[model samples]
Target chain A: MVSGHSSYVMKHHDLPIEVHDLTVSYQKKPVLYGVDLEIEEGSFVGILGPNGAGKSTLIKTIMNMIKPNGGYVKIFGDRPRAGIKRIGYIPQKESVDWDFPVTVFDVVLMGRYGHHGWLSRIGKEDRNKASECLEQVNMLAYADRPIGNLSGGQQQRVFLARALAQESAVYLMDEPFAGVDAVTEKTIISILQEMKKAGKTLMVVHHDLASAKEYFDQLLLLNMRKVAFGSVSEVYTHELLQKTYGGKLAVLSEMATEVAKNPEP
Target chain B: MKNWVIIFGGLLISSSFLEAKQIGSGEDLNWLTQAERFIEMKDPSIRKVALGALLMGLSCGLIGSYVVTRRLSLFGDTLSHAVLPGIAVGFIWAGEKENFSLLIGAGIAGFAGVCCLSLLKKFTKIHEDSSLGIVLSAFYALGICLLTRIQKVGYTDQSGLDSFMFGQVTSLSSGDIISLLITLLLIGLFITINFRQLLVTGFDPQFSKSIGIPNDFLQFLLWMLIAFCVISSLQLVGVILVSAMLVIPAATASLFAKRLKNYLVLSSLLGAGAGISGTFFSFLGKGLPAGPLIVLFSAFLFLVILFLRPEKGIIVCWLKARSERSRIIIENTLKATFKILEQKDFQENEITSLEIMKKRGLSRREVEREIDKLASSGFCTKNLSANDEANLPPQTVMILTPKGWEYACKIVRNHRLWELYLTNEAQYEPDHVHEDAEKIEHVLGEKTVRQIERLLKNPKLDPHGKFIPSITDIHQGNLPRPS
Candidate 1:
């Protein structure tokens, strides 16, 4: 397999994520409207948008979990199914049943599914890879404990661990720190930063505006019909955020003040 | 013998030989005598029928545990009833019920029904439960229609095949016993060898699938087990009552066991016991149908266990609550005494009993009883002193022992720490953090309390500006309320 760093851009004779006029919909309602974007190799890109702005939908479309209504999305210059092993996905924790009776070790082992494929045996090597991944997230101590028993921060670590075990060059994470504590958030961000330094591409759907600049080197600001994409210093302007948030944030602050007065018991 | 058991036993005993001319007529007594002598005579026919019912019930208990726990009882019910048409077709094809073609036809029809359910799920937008309902009921109705049509043809002796609706154990030949025993053995082997895979698939399908376990193959295995359970159970409980055999024992076993292995073993025992009791009850009830009797016996045992089991049992919880309420009265007395001391009106040494009773909402008689209990428990002392005001007795100072002081301080400290943590660490509004923290305080431990305290940077005051007593001060027991 070609290393992701050598192929930062398709135009440069190397492809990371290639898409052409991708249109995705769920039950006839369009989610991605004639979207076009390319992610270069080893780029630490953050997808920034308000809730329901298709940031998650975009990730799903790229992963091929959601089929495009029209056009195409390719990962690593090929159809997603042909190269699923080269991509790592860290879905929101709520996507899975938290109460499911599986250990952190077992959850991490699932990352090897794409590599092992269907009906193939998981060997001793896979177990060692899973253990190594858990150690990276500092969750090796809790590896044997049930995933359900972990705190929100610990659970997030295990998820990151699972993604690490995938050994994919391109990592996609959706709202990794939405409900996590500061310690866990910092740990996850540091891991992503380390991955970026190692010449691996990372795309995170980030919600916090304050930490967005520190966490991401590049930002993709999106609304339904409008979009802004560039470096954090170039794209993360007040006017752009206001446009992406659809101007509701001004009213949202007023509402926050009003709600804070009655202090929602 | 119980009347229910005798009736069922006689029905089972007489039905096999009842085809004989003399046996059906004046030799009814002779058949009974023969059954009694058969045991002593070591008759293979009697042994065959007895062993057939036993193994059939055992298999129903074994595979049925999964079927019932996974909640496929009604699906099993539908497949069993649907197999009637298959049985009819088999009989027609082979020109007799005894041919191997019948079992093959039944298996094919059952597998077909399973296929229909699967196909409906895959192709249609309809929900699985709805699709299952449609297929199960439709096949059963079709089978009933076919059975009615088949009745018009000759071979009216085939009418007794309706006994499959309510199992007729006496009719099972030695061949049936061997066939059932073999099916039972296969099911047992399948469960033992694939126990871990089945457990993962049953508990968490997505995780199992994600980890590269063959989910579809395991599902096929589960469906096959259900099919075998339904088919074998129908021979004893009949198509309609087969669900009872599949569900009752497993459901009862779940009440007692948490682990999968324990659940499987207990369910087997429950199933076997229900089966034996059901068979016995049917024997005792003359002319009573065995299918209904067996289902009723299992249902009775389920009801008995539901009401009488130790944990989560109705009567036991009620009893525990009543005793706990009595204990609360004594604890409340200690609390009241401590409260009075906080005012500084009651000195450190002792105070009059009347002063303590005055603060309580309870009646005079209730306060006296509570005080006696507290003094006996060493929580406080009562002042039997002469007081001038009416008949009011002076209550002695309620001084807590070192252990009591520490326990009280822990509860108070936890409540304060939680209030601080919720406001600071969790970012809850100052006004909203106190009530929830009140309940959480009782359950938190020292490690967790310390963790929260450290996270909040050892806040001296809570969100409401109330003093949070320091742990060092709490150990000293003279932690003053903030002025």
Candidate 2:
């Protein structure tokens, strides 16, 4: 249960993540039809919608993991790569191979590689910081454990630990709680609560409608286009939920596939 | 005399327009004699046929390790075999075996094969495995056919011809040694300058790419090195067995190492060892083939280490599993004993240890070890009212201190709560639920158990009709249930 509201002193005052008239396509069919959103700092924002809502594609475009066809996405009033150091990202856990021969310590150390640029070695200070991040996630006991041996929830925590080691100002987590145990979920929420207290912004791609109200402060209701974007209390109503996720999921999925195939538009 | 005639003849045929730098004179003859003596090791007239073989082995060992670890072993083999047609065509045109023209033709052909493979992979839907297989077999077969055509054209000496196929390690001269040395130096420089980049790219290309490392460029560089190394070592290992030279050493080293640097270094050492040992064996055994001998030695080392290494070996994994099962049984017995003590309140006298063991369905020896472990850990006290050692019935009633009872109850509570959570909340089908919950309950902490209890709204019974423990301790209560 995250329950503290601290005084928000915004130097920029504007929303940390802002997207305006964002349109994306694959080939020539539009996937995102003028989707727009705004998210504030010190907020836990859940990007909520059913499968194939272009929710993942939208985030990837915002992160510059993929180039958008036509859109404007600003993180801290700049491009995603410019603010990469300030933005920590946890990609879907399944995207990586667990059988890869690396220990928990080795994987977490890679977070600092971005900081220590190419041809530069990681220093003692970076190592100490990585250790601290591992401690925060309670994964210090398994620091030397091969990543392959860990359970699904443990692997997710290790990924989260890597992001924490980055010590970024914002976090974008894609499906952090998917296949995670209840305890691991609580651990993640508590860490997010602490980050929130420290005035860091977090955007999570979330499923599990039952816990959406309990977990999120702000919500981006998406279904290939902007359904709603506001505080969860304002945007997470039954009507908006239905619009964002219910009957529109199948139509959005078909549109997403067609759009994915037609990327040029 | 035949070797010299073939070489000079080939040289004249390729660069006939360029003047020969004054036929072998006094100074050159003296240098050649010293080189031949050094190789012979005390033989008066070019003592050792094995020296040429040794130099070839050394070059192949050094460069082959990198190729194997990078998974470019097949590429090495394909490129090696593809050089045959170049050798054949160079000989056919020059009317004699010529090193320079053959090398040029081989380089062009090898590069052509690489280009074809990459283009096919990029432009077509055919997978890389099938594509490489097609290219390797087709080019190699063409080379063999060209070799047959060249052999029939009245060139009977065939000194250079024999070296390209199965390899003529014994025929290596001082000139061949110079080429091998140059290739070694190039490979050493590559491994030194970009060691870290090569390692990271090999281990995880996606991660290297994400961190803004130019992985594609590095991959291209790596493939280029592979091509260079293959061309250099093909004379020594031959087209057919070159892949063995590349793959065996790295495969052997992986069994011995966990880190990338150690694996690379160990691979080199294994390769060098195999090369040296195979050379020695080939010398002693008269006609024993060196390439296959070296590969066999490496394979033998890998198998020995795989089955025998201390911590992570096959034998160790088996032993660890057996011990783990025994430990789990003992831990559970201790847990069951503590449970009985809490329920009975330590008031019943003359309660034999056997009674507890029978109640828990544990063996007597297991129960005894559990009691000993509990006593040693200070979880319980034993031998309080001592009497006659053997004849007097032993006071076997077990009692747990507050600390022990709390720990025991925590475990029991976690187990029951998980069973309920798995059955109801997780929607795990009933028959499959118990074993998963059983394993998970032992590892989960009180904090998680509390969270699960709250999520299930302090559920009274599991889906299987077993009662779940309620959180009683105020300090370790439940989290607020989601609305």
Candidate 3:
């Protein structure tokens, strides 16, 4: 696997995330329209948007969880399925049933599913990798505890640890800080920064405007479409944020919000 | 009217076996003798039936783990009900109760039911629950019409077809058991081959897709396996009660398991356990159907787990809360005693009950009762004053023993330190910290107390300008305690 460095980008090579005129819809209603983006390697990017602004839709489309109707997503200049093994995804915590009969360790070990074959038993290397990820999130103490027995913060950390154990070059996190305690938020941000330092690209869907400036080096301002995408000081301006959050696309936003909350396959 | 007649006829046949045994004995069947007969495994027919029950339980319970966990309990019910038509068609096509014909027909009908569900979801605006209800009742009605029509035709080979509705476990031949054995082996091998991928897909589909897992294929395979399980167990548990076998044993094991592997293993055991016990009791009563009897046994098992299991059980949670409530009460009483001593500037160790009543805002009787509780716990002693008999009754004064004084000081320190910490670390207003600290003081562990002290730099004064007692002063029970 090629290291995700922008030296390749400077040589006009494949970007970590390359999207051109992507359009996505659900139930014959559009959620994302004509969005374009290119993310450099090792950049800590925060996608700041209001509810139903298609932030999650964009990430899902990129991962091929949802296909774009208009355009396409390319990771390192290939189709998503071909490049999906190089990406780690941490979905919203509310998306899963915590009452499932699986321990924190078992959840983390699931991150290694892509690394090994389906028939092979979970080896010792996978166990060690999972615990290492748990240790990074300060959840090693709760590794043996059932997922339902954990608090909300611990559940969030378990998913984050799973993402870490995936050991992918690109990480996509959806609302990692939502519903977690202040201490857990701090730990997650620090880990994201560490990942950025290690030449890994990180894209986080963040809702808080105040912390968005401090947490991310780049910001992807989105509403129903791409309002702005650039450095935090440039795209995070008040004018652009107002344009993204303003109710110009009321019908589109409302329909997309309902669709996102009750997604059907 | 016809449906009701068919159902009643099936019931009458089920109960008639017991009537024959009762008439032979001229009384109730001997339960002890039946139990000995079952345990001896001396009869080949009895052994075959028992083995058949055990096999059904193991496979249904194993597959049921996935059914409940995937939120497909209702789907399992619909699928089981929908296979009735296939069973009837297979019986007519083969001109007998042929296992191979029945298996193929059931598998086709089950798969067709799933396909219909997908089509309904894709083409129509009808929701999932309504679609399932339509398919289940529709297929079931078709099966009922065929069954009643066949009985009207009156063929000799149709003599044992009613057993399909409510199983006649005694009628299971060795051929039936062999087919069931093969089906279960296939289910086991499939699960082992695709265990990790199936688990990840079940828990989180989007995440699985991101990792390039073929989620749709795995789900289709799982649906097929569920159909196989229901089909194989039909002769032992029957169609109407088959879903109970799938859901109950898994739910029973979920109470004890914290992981998927444990859920699978423990559910299989509980399934086997219910099977043996139900078969035993059915043998004992001499008239009980295995379907209802097995379901009842598993339901009883679930109730036991709900009430008696450790940690997550309702009874255990109630008991834990009760103890926590009493501990909070004890801590509050100790804090009241400390505040009484503080009001006097720590000039004495003994406090009058009137002072406690005023400090704790309790009635005089309440204060005396609290003191009695403290005395019994070895925290304090109660003495009657000489002037107590002067005013129609003796006056009570409580003297704290060293242990009592130590606890009192510790409670005071915890309260003050929490108040200080809230104002400093949490940025709470000074006046707002007391109410929150009221609850936090009782639960703060020693490690947290040390952290609070360190963060506050060992403050001697709380937000309200009260002197925070030290642990050493608490142990010494010293009046006018030093900083």
Best-matching candidate per TM-score: 3
Error of 1 at B174 (Å): 4.6
lDDT of 3 at A11: 34
Compare candidates 2 and 3 on DockQ and give the better one.
3
Q: Write the per-residue lDDT of candidate 2 for residues B82-183, one digit (tens) a residue.
A: 666767777676766665676667777787888888899778999777888888877876676666555545575655664666554555455555665666
Candidate 1 vs candidate 3: the TM-score winner is: 3
Q: How close is candidate 1 to the true structure, as a TM-score?
A: 0.64
Evaluate fnat for each of the predicted models and list the values in order: 0.04, 0.10, 0.80
Tell me how many clashing residue pairs each candidate has.
26, 6, 2
lDDT of 2 by residue, A8-108 (tens): 52543255776768888876777788876666778888888877788777877777666777778888888777766767778776667565456788878
Candidate 3, chain A: TM-score against the reference: 0.88
Candidate 2 Cα outliers beyond 4 Å, as residue runs = A1-39, A72-75, A246-265, B1-111, B154-158, B171-205, B312-483
iRMSD, per candidate, in listed order: 5.3, 3.0, 1.1
DockQ, candidate 2, vs. native dimer: 0.14
Query: How displaced is residue B437 in candidate 3, in Å?
Result: 9.2
Q: Cα lDDT for residue A241, model 1?
A: 66
Q: Each candidate's root-mean-square deviation in Å?
A: 9.9, 13.4, 7.1
Candidate 2 or 1, higher DockQ: 2
Question: How do the candidates rank by DockQ, highest first?
Answer: 3, 2, 1
lDDT of each: 0.69, 0.66, 0.81
